[model samples]
Target: MIFNRVSYGFAAAAAGAFLFFAPAAQAMTKIERVVSPGGIEAWLVREPSVPLIAMEFSFKGGANQDPVGKPGVAYMAAASLDEGAGDLDAKAFQARAERNAVELSFRASRDEVRGSLKVLSDRKAEGFDLLRLALTKPRFDQEPVERIRAQMLTALKRETTSPNEIGSRLWWRTAFPNHPYSLPTNGTLESVPTIVRDDLTGFVSRTLARDNLKVGVVGDIDAKTLGTVLDQVFGALPAKSDLRAVPQARPEAVGKRLEVQLDVPQTVVAFGGSGIPRKDPDFIPAFIVNHILGGGSFSSRLYNEVREKRGLAYSVYSYLLPLDAAALFMGGTQTRADKANEAVGLIEEEIKRLAENGPTEDELEKSKSYLKGSYALNFDTSTKIAGQLVQLQVDDLGIDYWERRNGLIEAVTLDDVKRVARRLLNGGVLFTVVGRTQTAASAKQGG
Candidate 1:
């Protein structure tokens, strides 16, 4: 259910944002690979678009692999890599990267972690070397460790005060319980202080195995040269860990409604339960159903009912989150505390109605067309194509997943949508309300 893939093909940028879409006809996808002596392998795609090159390296068992008592170790390690590697301190590294117009980022999700590099095509060699150093020879110096720790602590403090963060934290804790999926990828306040440099060292040493790594290079590099680059970068890594030995996710406990009272003008409510797991046979159908239900903005039921019709909130929507082990489907909205209860009620009623009836033919058609039309946009640039490659590799989605993705979405039917909706939306749907004490009291008063 790892849903780092959750942000599907959402076009957050206008064509002008990246020099126009370059026409769908010009977009193409092909797979080529290189094998290193260390047994590390990389899949690459050559897109000679902008004078830019991008690569994504994905490692297995991101947050889920955190050892006992060191819940956030994996995430900290990912962040720390860029802080110092070899002779470059954080500042020096940033200077070098900016000087070369390189964008280097490391991010973690429940299932996998990623390190990405994007640079001018002419600077590919230097950028790749820098990335290699960060991966293979990161210098987890103590001074930067303390600085990073304090920064994270401050960020966590701010996040805890936010209503969206409050609801999400509570929901995962209730749903996953003892499971790794239950923990925040970013460590909790209490856990952050306990993570030390040695913790990071041990985690990276144990986790950065050759077989655990997969990379994709896209842009101006061809398969042969990319293979050589992959070897020089990740080729020396140790053997792969026993991947199958990883623990399986436990069944989610039935979640309960929780309300956190703060001083605020609006009440933010998140409602739903464990949805469809990523590897579940019904995942594709569940995704289609979710889009039809609330994922599609103007065309979705939640937008039409909650905003356009009643004007309850500025935004209202539902989404499915498939983690490595568990899936969560949630609908959310922010409204006046007095109207919060009514908003939650409307969301549930609509879910129940869909469970009983299913989407109409028109809704089904629109969702399909939207999904199909969006496929080409996935290859808009090297950065995006590289990212998609890493994700599909991590999911074992097969190299040809992009070629067949549209077909899968097209195969989903109205009956399939109803079946998944009915199967997923059941029991006491967990509801999380975050707002001021007065707002919580008002919502309770109406209840």
Candidate 2:
């Protein structure tokens, strides 16, 4: 899902333009911290060049907070927030948003519920008011509740037949069997219909609190003004959250392969194992090692070995997925059903090679240069800037992260990469494949 690109057209345009003209030379971003009179705090970046303002915020509770039988409560709650709020009905609220060119949206990931707002500077008051209303007084009207629930149900049904979707679902389910991470962020078909208005309301009431909130604002707003707006938007929420403590978990079913027999042309193979957490000292080194192994686009070893030389798959890559409660090294590729075993074998061989020999100096330098150059993409637009700032807060990266990031990457030596490679790549791997493969079926049956 991290790779899925949802088009916020204007936001995309701004990001694209910013990147296009960005200098190859790197520079540190200036970030300001603003604390409100009500004790609310936010990260702020002022950019008066654009008349529009973008704010991104997140709360700690997410799908992880859903009750045992209510898998998608947080997700459904996100969908219903803007449908109706305070005194406005669904249609009326939407109409008011459209009239002022305000863009408001919410999303639920495995660890957090995030919201984004974009509006013209002239309409800041209206935009802030609408957001406050949504946060504090969402109606969760029956019509909208049923409508959104139906939509999620439809998506779940569709996923049943999608190889990529099915493979991902089964991978997590198999990897974290007893943990909340095993459940789909969007509830299953059975769980979705059981969600009610009270479920949605309860999720919002318990999760949206001052203690767990992180916010970032960009464009046409000063610290003083943003401080006032922060309190106005968030001060009314409860000071504390009622979230349950999620226990730490790691991927299970390691060194095992599971197969689902779907009649798809290409087999979808999802593989992962243990990973370094964001707070770990070895994370940056692990990141550099991952880039050389698979995270780098076409230049990566996996891409070259799997796609170019052997033609086993069109794409192959891996990444470090550091969630709040768990960290993972995950990757996937699609290949002919009959070639699934061969593809998996090749991936394992490549991992072994990286673990044993590490990357060449040439590869390491190239990866470092690419990473340093692309850093500007993270701050290409007001929305993107705010989003990155909020994420930094969530990761507990210091306020000076932007300034320190490149130096951290630059300090990763060849020795460090090799050490982390052995640390991470030498672990047991879990593989989940969905397709018509005799080898896969045999593995599933313990053959």
Candidate 3:
């Protein structure tokens, strides 16, 4: 009998062991590139010990492809895929999935439409067939489309009063004013209702094509079997996507601050600035620098300064957020309305300090150790491995990135970290504050 679900109850224990005792033993699991008879290619990691399979695939052109007037069409279309497919109605399709003990879902992000499938090895055929149907023959039935659309609209309505959500949305809007990246993934209220079945169908047709697809699979699957499944699942897609080219953009509104006045007791602050891209040669050094500055949990400078030292906020940290079109270094904190300016001031001061002097040699060594030692936690399960593989492909990192990642971090010298720190943190930060703030008047006055 096939296991209905893969359990990771002991994953925490195993991860702990790996982190403490086997840190240096971190090694890349073998990855093989498989090409189908029809020429569909996929990255596969065969793990015969497990009886299940996990596959992740993505197609370029996500919400970024949504037409001028239709911002949420891609997101809605992804949600609609598993609702019904081919000859199966909504209920029947979901019933089939349950009977087969398969998990299938789709998501739309700023740069890609991604899908995930997990099933027992014995039921591979059924799992692949369901995925194929969702990709190539999604029914986009009226009922499912309306149901998902309504749910999204309700969420958007709730976002109006959500300080965190409001702050994040405002940050993006201010950062990428005229760009598609500024558009909400779930879309605005006006755009969700405008989405129709035709729009969903068109999105699938134009975006889900072979040329733009990247796939990664893990667990009890071999190269030969995966090659066959790849073609059976994706061979029917168009040779090329009809996606519009998205131009490169940088985060705007730097050195400016915007405040949305709310009656809430606590104010939420969201801030962002320029960042190094994933493909930049200095990315490894930049990653280390960020860890010492804010990416590290309790050990980071921001956390020590903002929360532990002054007790001005409950939490504060910053990290790199590299997107396909732009890169950003962003951070957030929540504090009492009265202390909002103090929190923002401390954040700015820390950023300036890092840019000016960079991390000390001790700070640099500690960050590299933590980063390298904690890397083993990412591969404690087949699903995690599969997810990492997919992300590596999306970032255009070479197939051997898993093996080389640790070395890259270890090789960053003190000079490299200081250089990247100055490069990334020298830029002005744009701040967006939501909720009651004593600084609101001054912020707006300056803007």
Candidate 4:
């Protein structure tokens, strides 16, 4: 999933969890790239100030590795990872973790299967043991599998009536057509049920291997100790993952407006189009531009134009969504059913306006300042810091990326913003709305 959220809460297609955490305060954080004797590497931040340690790691392939008919195999596998392991049953395993104060979970996102662990420094041995077993010796017992699948089935059922889910998934299906990108990260209603134990085990063996792993740890653990922990927990996995090649894709059906008419009171709107990938030279500038356009909260052009001035919707937002396979410029809003067309029209107008003229000098400077100033807040906690390091590794940003991040923001020149604005927004966005709207007959958007 893209760290920048897709509005309607479904942009990453919501297979599972993706948590965004910023690096710790620049002065306090020193990231250590620790490599184990067994050749495992982890980014570590030793914060003895807290007795708790937090670690996060991920394997490269997520739902992208699911078999053709089973979209949620990765998701179900991840959710079931800790259900039992080695000699432990589900109840015993969970109880042991609780007694030792270990917090652990696994989740599948669009691009990776992720795991997080937190434990008291005194309980490190027990926590690491549990994690190791979960990774290399997961049981995937039948009872637990049925339980987790049932839970997921219930959630999918709820999404049937959720306008947000309907609109978000519809937009994705429209955007990518036949590619894997079009499928929900969590499989469709029909595919999940057929995922048996063999499928879950296949996903693990094919994707969760040492070569594709990235790890980050924060709090209490020193580099030498962490090196040992890394080897112990990860050393036993297969040396290489058998990840299949997934093609790079671009959003299709640009400038088109599609709808699903449900009898909801307010309309759910999701819109997006082509975007710059994370590694693109212009991405940082695009990020700042997006902030000024819609991410600046109450002061953004989108919020000010659509909500504060015209009162068409209660909230409106846009973000840059750079995924492993594709990138997107996305946004969402909800408004009274009667006002859906006007709200969408106003959104398009603002997009066109921004792409045509670019942001004002004031908007540019303030957004830069806000973005730089608020960054360290994301890493205030040990869990957040740990998660962030893992994410940075996934993005392949340098070990020193955090130190240089604010400077990059400062360097986004007016010309840079203007160029990226036209480059990104001029193409227009695809709109997928759910609800009965007053202007159902309105011409298709992105035309």
Candidate 5:
């Protein structure tokens, strides 16, 4: 009986046929506001589910706000919070959280830092107090800080020699030169050593302003009570300067090729061109195109060509990283050293073919259908919905974005998709190879 929920696949199949046939349904869900006495603002959705409460605290200026030479300050600070807080030691705090069945975590992305908390209804006060301590009174204990820093440093040192990491970092640096977005979210070795306690403190103080905080609470909680809880957690944060201003991203050099030789059996190749920014009028169409290209998993062009037909790589995929200023379209595959070049060639050929002759009607319909039909599955939980809402807010999407999102996907026409593919995929494509060099003898021997 539970298997009946698996209707998304069929719904997706019907998406293409009904694109223009059905009228848009009423989509807006009225967001309940939670306004605290301290002037904190939050969107509260009260669902009396299983006696639990989940809240998301989102602050602007995530990894992008990391100071130059300190690339991972945001991540480092986020990681340090759980290590120690208030008077409790790191292990003690963790044990306490587990004992109380509370889930509190911090994560940092390019443009936002999120602190999430989930707890039982009865222990909401205590759970929230612990979260507040982590947010506003983290100790940055020397012992735990050093241990975590050493762990991260060791990882960075190891990743430097990894072919996958080498190719990925190279792509970002080449694709986004002179932009904060170009910096690695994980701090480099040189930068990690310089991150003192004061650096973490200063970053938290400046970036965690009340004005910059957006709270979303869901589950068994009233708007009034949730507003009070928000104040308890975020009211102590000092009012500081707006840290939301992101630096303008420089234009990416498309169609560029880069190669790195590492002693390995397989070569890793990453290639693609620029893509539409989040605010582009063609964003929906471009999204559809991306899904058709590789974002649709087994049903995509790259997978069909590279994996199924030529067997060039075990897996190949493409995706669109649509940001505020610009978008980066990237894809990659790993193959045997000798076959690496051939695989890259095939990928390039496919890119050119898509440019020269746009997607077929069938392909376009399948892509649009998949894009619209599968979106509902992404919001199965309140936590996920809150996260999506935060991103929509950061992108300046309207309040009714979630309601109208499916309609926009349906509006993307075949021509619209073709136009975006031509316009956005013009950057100098980078060809990065990370593997052992094939000797002349090996080349001649076809080994």
Candidate 6:
């Protein structure tokens, strides 16, 4: 499945070294809007320096569109797309892909059916055709279907009691009760067994179409040429998507605390509260405020108070999860089971402190400088730019967003930061803790 949402609420950011090429990357990124002969639209960034082409595209329906009592239908459908199609069986299709060195895959994310393709410039033709077939004519033969099902079943069994998985799932379920947004993107063990061939076929027919699509391409391609390829690949699909409308959802039960008992030594903690959606005017400020609160790694208040000063945990962090239907601010930490209560209490203290007193002028300036400087890394490679383009389209951020983004960050005044801090953090966050077999009482408010 398209697992851009796969990390759930607590997936830690992978540690990495910074490669700063901010100036050149900013100058080199000139996004062009490309419309095909058949009127398919795509965002293109040309990087002739690279000999490869990478494309990312998505249709707006995802695993959330899973039928009632049948979560993971879209996931199974996405995973099975390349197993077989048209004249090629699963083996033949995979062999062709391997021989051509073309990388192509599809996923069912919470909000979209997403796909990515990468190929040597010379092999792009094979790659695009393979993507077309996979999108339009998947065979979904029984053998490959059975194999993938078994693999998914194995993973589900392994994760049945996993601390992180259990805590993350619980957080979502509790936050969005009885809503499709609460359903596991991967179908549950109970739901997966009942899924049959028709569900897969039906998901493809209803969800994958031109009207709901967005495309992005980068590396060694001109707008004129990509226009033709776009039509050849996506032009044949039906113009309209047959999708059920998903309503806007808000996270429920703020300040509610729940815990699961397990034997693990480290308690896994997930906490979050109301968020300003990406489209909100306050999101950029919220983004900056969040960086100061917990998103900035070593420099954040949470890391400094809980880990740097008290040494209660090796890591602590948070993020703004603005889904298509909901806006959420979430964070997580792992610490000694005995220290879970302390870590959580400190986190609560920092959030309320920031909400009551906005970040200092120096902290605000540092966060802005860091955000502007780090943005260049987003465009350092063709793949990264392509991914960003697709996401920009998904967010409906205008074509000029890249040009305007840093300016928006620069425009946030101290007053703006304070206003958004209360907007996002004034109310306390919900908490879900796993691995503290002894009940850790609710987070106590104190300095």
Identify the candidate with maximal lDDT: 2
Roughly what TM-score does model 6 have, to 2 decimal places? Answer: 0.93
The digit string of per-residue lDDT tens for model 5 on 1-447 reads 000111232224334331222112221155576789989887765666346666777888788888767887888888888776898988887777766667777877787777877666777887788888888889889988887788778888888788888877777777778777777787788888888898888778878888778777666788888878878988898876457467566446566566777777788888756777888788788777777777888998888988999888888888887665556787888998888777877878877777767778899888878777777665556666556656666677766777778888878787887777776554446666667645321111000
RMSD of 5: 8.2
lDDT of 2 at 316: 92
Q: What is the TM-score of each candidate against the true structure?
A: 0.88, 0.94, 0.93, 0.93, 0.87, 0.93
Minimum summed lDDT over a 10-residue window in model 1 is located at 1-10
What are the C-alpha RMSDs, in order, of all predicted structures?
Answer: 5.1, 3.3, 4.6, 6.0, 8.2, 5.6
Error in Å for residue 299 of model 2: 0.6
User: Candidate 1, TM-score vs. the true structure?
Assistant: 0.88
Tell me which residue pairs clash in candidate 1: 1-322, 1-323, 1-324, 2-323, 2-324, 262-436, 275-327
lDDT per residue, candidate 1, 111-228, as tens digits? 7778877666777777888788888888899887787788777878887678888777776676667777678888888899999778887777777877778787776777667767
lDDT of 3: 0.83
lDDT on C-alpha atoms for all candidate structures: 0.73, 0.85, 0.83, 0.84, 0.73, 0.84
- Decoy 4 TM-score against native: 0.93
Query: Residue 412 of candidate 5: its Cα lDDT?
Result: 76
How many clashing pairs per prediction, in order?
7, 0, 0, 2, 10, 3
Candidate 6 lDDT for residue 22: 19
Error of 4 at 185 (Å): 1.6
Expressed as tens digits, the lDDT of each residue in 1-447 for candidate 2 is 211112244344345443232222232266789999999989987776666788999999899999887898999898888988999998898888776667788989999999988877877898899899999999999998888888888888888788888778878888888889999898888899898888888899999999999998877778999999998999999999999999999898888888888888999998999999999999998999999989997999999999999999999999999998888999999999878888999889999999999888899899999998788877656677889889999999989988889899999899999899999898878988888876536333110
Ranking by lDDT: 2, 4, 6, 3, 1, 5
